[model samples]
Target: MGLTQTQKAMVEKARAAGGSGQAIPLSDDACVCLIGIIARDLGLSDHFPELPSDLPPFFDQREPGSLNISGVEFLPLMERLVKLNPDSDTFFSCLANLHKRRLKYERILQTQPIPTIEQVGPRGLLQFGTISATTLTGLLFWRKWFFDIDNRAGQETGYLFEPIIAHAIGGVPFSAKASPVRRAGDSRKGRQVDCIRQQKAYEFKIRVTIASSGQGRWQEELDFPVDCRQSRYTPVLVVLDATPNPKLDQLEAAFLRQQGEVYKGESAWEHLESVAGPTMGLFLEKYVRDPIQALLNKVSDCLPEFVARMDKDGITLSVAGESMLIRRTLGAADDEVQELPDDASDQIPGP
Candidate 1:
């Protein structure tokens, strides 16, 4: 399949920023870097007899106290190695190891401090100036409470929450309600999943009940699709609330017992408290915060298992100028893009 518009735009931007004619495509640098590291860590040549002698040179290029070879240069070498032993368990293990290393590197980057105005040169300053202007515009736009009244009414009908949650979690909303297949002699009903992130399905529930019977019904709602589609995607239940419901603990436990997952108001509150402060944290946790933190936690927990499974299954590894997008989009629909909330006014303080 061809690259999506967003992917194409990224390539174009990279080229415009002097990334042209680079041996490694700008986008695949991190993956390629991790690939080299993983290969050395796994001792691919030593373990896999089929590995070509030239493969060692790629890893040998690492200089002490200096940058390793660019992913661009490493790409063809990796591709050749994969072709040499396409079905080797040791080869696929390196790919899984690469993913693990990349995840750790990304976590490190997130924790690092942002560059200051002086630290960033002229180009960086220009980028930050645009970012600051956009942020201020967003703040002023959200300052309008009067416009939110109508927007809240629209939200109550449950038309916009899925897109909002999907956007916040960096996931795509599943367009169709139910899978194409139907249970024998049973009428097709709408599936509850609203959004999907990292191969996990998420269903959003607003104002769920605290009673035992109500909780049972909610559990059923969350579990059915997961039971049916567990092989394809893991399931997460996100319960949006106006207040902290103590009974949700029971529901969460029940879902977890069934191999399903749950994230409620309390989880959102805890996340916001860390990032947005106590006051705004309480407000957002009660009102507009999406279950992004919960979804991230789920992804982090699942990734190791996912990598192991991929390695065992021997997923097709391509290092020749392919993007990480190709690795992630293996089973997902490329056309199904995540939709962002149309207006900031859509968010209103809950009672």
Candidate 2:
């Protein structure tokens, strides 16, 4: 995920340009056009490099000048996908392409060890225990399907509400529906209230999977209530390195085809929640933004370094702004798994 010689030069050129003191706002289409130019220049066609472990950059210095551009920073390029000549095909095409790159990044991290785990059995039992004796609230839910008999066709009708719930909470429903209230005055107790109340509550139990790493596994389940009538989710999924802890894990979800089956399985919600502890939104904040501040260390010219990394990490240009100051995280370290090329030094010679 480091920068190449060409990318380094591109950024340096922009640094020398002395840009207009205005932040340029590009639509998703503009972002893609920029990325297309970059990809071609980088020779990323037949094969693109895997994204670096340190992804989703966060930038701080919003200066009053034109920002630099480079091929290595794919996120800015990707932001343009929504801007292609014909919107429909390009938008989806951009998403699918980015998703594929994400998966490659996740696979790279799955093999590394930040913590350990042990698989118990296939009744689908696994365990995750914290290193220190600490209490952590792990959320859980289950994925389920209920069928009711339809009198008209003498066939069963499927209830399709669970997926909507799943998309929102990112966990299976674990809470159970309340029992139906007794019919109004069937016996002779007292009141005759003629209205029937329908209980629309359901819970999903999540089953978890643990790798064979040698460490005690902690297990817990939680219930997330979903009202299909209440909300809608922007069904997006991201794949990248990083192990799933009680707090978070990378998710591989899709709104289409078999990939959607990633949400299937009985009470597998427990497993889903174990991973769900972490959301992509959270990563967008912590990993990208926090890290940028940590890298800047309050120095100004070094701001460009932060910018290059930001573009490398996929920090949306629009969101980071043109001139903003980033404060360093209290004790952040350079845990970068890959090293960026010295784009600042390597420039082409003029004839």
TM-scores across all candidates? 0.31, 0.18
- Cα error, residue 52 of model 1, in Å, equals 62
Off by over 4 Å in 1: 1-157, 177-190, 211-222, 225-231, 242-250, 269-287, 290-351
Per-candidate local distance difference test: 0.39, 0.25
Clashing pairs in 1: 23-72, 24-72
**lDDT string, candidate 1, 18-80, tens digits:** 211111222344434434543454345453333333433322323211223342543354454
TM-score of 2: 0.18
Residue-wise lDDT of candidate 2 within 1-351, one digit each (tens)?
A: 433454433323322311211112233333333344333333333333332222221122332121223335444334332232212222222222222222222222222221112221221232224322221111111000001101111110011122222322322222212112221223222111111112222222122334423332221111011111121211222212223443223222112221221233322333333432433223222423244345434545533422311223321223235433222122211122221122211111100
How many clashes show up in model 2? 46
Candidate 2 lDDT (Cα, 0 to 1): 0.25
Task: Point to the candidate with the largest TM-score.
Answer: 1
User: Cα miss at 56, model 2 (Å)?
Assistant: 20
lDDT for 125 in candidate 2 is 30
